[model samples]
Target: MTVIAVTGHLHLTDPTVHLVRAALGRLLAGHPAAALTGVSCLAPGADALFADAVLAAGGALVAVIPSPAYRDTLDAGYTAEFDRLRHAAAEVLVLPFDTPDADAYEAANTELLRRADLLVAVWDGLPGNGRGGTAHMVAAARRAGIPVEVVWPEGAGRRPAPPA
Candidate 1:
């Protein structure tokens, strides 16, 4: 089976969300449903979109939560979707961290990379602003010899301000 992991920005515009979903769906369509396993953190933006596409394509999902309190850090609006995705995951891995912090996020990213055979990034080809960002993960994946596929569809763009 081929394992695909995702990393991307969480602040996407509405139009960009549709574009990302379509792009991810098209990519997932290239593989046999039963042979594809998607790994993600199930975060609000790209991660959630990837998980949805994986489930729609009949692929298994593996969710890697950054910390035990990761759910608490999510916006209230995303809780239901996050819970649904978590419930749908074939395997749920909660890291040893107690809280959601930068270090915890970085560790989670490392674990995702370690488990992924291929990394499907929904990045906009920009440099990451800080640690554990999509750009950082992509670079790490390349260094580890994991194949990386960037999925930034035409006209897709990030929101001007990040989600609060």
Candidate 2:
């Protein structure tokens, strides 16, 4: 059984989100619900979308919140999203402590990857040489010998296409 963990940027909407959802749906189409377990960080955008798809496919949704008192720390938008996930997820696990910043998000990502057999990432290019987000998480997963599935829409980061 594959325990899949999904990590992605929370800033997307509409076509990008739609494209990612469709891509993930297609990628998961052949797997049985019984053979899959899902984990998400419960953020907006891709995280929520992945959880929804997992549920729709009759797979369990395990939400790993960054903090137990997340409502106290998150902005109104994120708080609302967390509440929605509380109701939607079959299981929810709050991290033992709060993260202070980007480092914490990375730590949380590592934890999720540690428990996952597969890591699915949805990333939008953030310019420059920093890799503290989903990109870092994918690299870590690869280093740990877990398979990674990256789903970014066409032109997401401007990777050049092969010549016709």
Quick one: best TM-score, which candidate?
1
Candidate 1 residues 19-65, lDDT tens each?
A: 99999999999999989999999999999999999999999999999
Runs in model 1 with CA error above 4 Å? none
| TM-score of every candidate relative to the true structure | 0.97, 0.82
- Kindly give the stretch of ten consecutive residues in candidate 1 with the minimal lDDT sum: 155-164
Model 1, residue 74: C-alpha shift (Å):
0.5
Model 2: weakest 10-residue lDDT segment is 155-164
Please give the distance, in angstroms, between residue 22's alpha carbon in candidate 1 and its true position after superposition. Answer: 0.7
Model 2 gets an lDDT of 0.74
Q: Can you write out model 2's per-residue Cα lDDT over 1-164, one digit (the tens) per residue?
A: 87899977766756676788888887777679988788988777678878877877778888877766555755576677678777878787777765535655666787788789888887664432244467777778889999988788894433332253
For candidate 2, what's the RMSD?
6.3
Residue 160 in candidate 1, Cα distance off native in Å? 3.1
What lDDT score belongs to each candidate, Candidate 1 first?
A: 0.94, 0.74
lDDT computed for candidate 1: 0.94
